[model samples]
Target: MASNNRQNSKMTDDGANVTSTPSHDTRQASSSIHVNNLSYDATEEQLYSSFCVCGDIKSVRIITDRLTGNSRGFAFVEFKNTTAVSDAIKLDGMRINGRPVKITVAQPRNSINDNRVVQNREEYQRNTPSRTRVVHCKKSQYDVYIGRPEYWGNPFVIGKDGDRSDVIRKYRAWIMKKPEMLERAKTELRGKVLACWCKPEACHGDVLAEIADND
Candidate 1:
């Protein structure tokens, strides 16, 4: 929240002393906002233009697959202040490219780092042979659901069979359509030590944590 110091003035060639206002450091004032359920074809320009109506954007970063280089159906928009953050929050449940995008303030980088440590620990605990295995449902984008589908275990089959990518895409689309389901998942998962397969970068588990903790 700290800003750059404003400097006192100096006399110019015109013999007038001017006091320069402190410049807003978008980086220092910057806060990240998460945007999910983006259309695969959504462009950075479109995102920038939409959010800029609320505040000056520091940057727009869209997450993409490492190998395929395709949009992961999400992005992080950085804004200059809490006011902009509030403005952007109004965009949540609003349509973007014919689909409603889920918007929330991203967790602090340090908190996310701390989560990695906890996630890894929980992941290890869940994988232990002694613990009872829970159902594996790929129903939501967050991987929270009741029934385990057969495709999940054997996602890579031949001829006409769908792969993991297909499953993820379908799940993302499904959850985006029914955000109530996501809220339900967050409510159910709150306060429990759940495993997070995705770490370091943002993940659905983190989203659930953010929602639950805030509530």
Candidate 2:
């Protein structure tokens, strides 16, 4: 057996710290119990049959390995009433197949990433500015400023007379420029438009007029 770590603690067969009941406000009307310390040889049907003594059973599942299809040594048994779940926990550590069992209320499965992945993703998004854009420079220049052509003078107009090396350097800086306006423009365009085109009219006059009117 592999030694257990915090990340894989819930995978254990000992239900001691493996399972917990839902909060008073969230407890379901149905009674769902987690059974641990199950015999690797025990089948799902056997587990359902064993727990049926407490009350009517709704479902049973013996969790198994995905790759090998072998039992993970734990199972979930659901009863028709919440009272059954309470009663089952009292029978915790009861013997089954010559081995003691651990029983408790079953909890919902945490997603694969859970809190750790969420925190990391949030931190990354926070540290990095969302509006930054990367553009390649056509010319070489160390210093460059990025602004809209309508608002800021055309960069190409100034670089046109410079030496080839200087022009290349300036274009490179333009490519690397990160501007707030560019970020805003990207945000405005994102997901707003779909890849689509209007059907063309066989003739130019009325069809063009109709298209313009529709716009």
Top model by lDDT, which number? 1
- For model 2, how does the per-residue alpha-carbon lDDT over 99-165 read when each residue is reduced to its tens digit? 7899978865456657788899789767854332222233322122232343322244334647544
Total clashing residue pairs per candidate?
Answer: 0, 10
lDDT of candidate model 2 versus the reference: 0.55
lDDT, each prediction: 0.62, 0.55
Which whole-number lDDT from 0 to 100 does residue 6 have in model 1? 59
TM-score of each: 0.41, 0.39
TM-score of 2: 0.39
Model 1, 1-215: lDDT tens per residue?
Answer: 65467577889999999878766754333377999999888888989988999898989999985433568799999887667988898889887777889999885566667999999978975675422122223322433332223211222222344554554445444444554554554466555443433333333434344434332
Worst 10 residues of 2 by lDDT: 193-202
Off by over 4 Å in 1: 1-30, 111-215
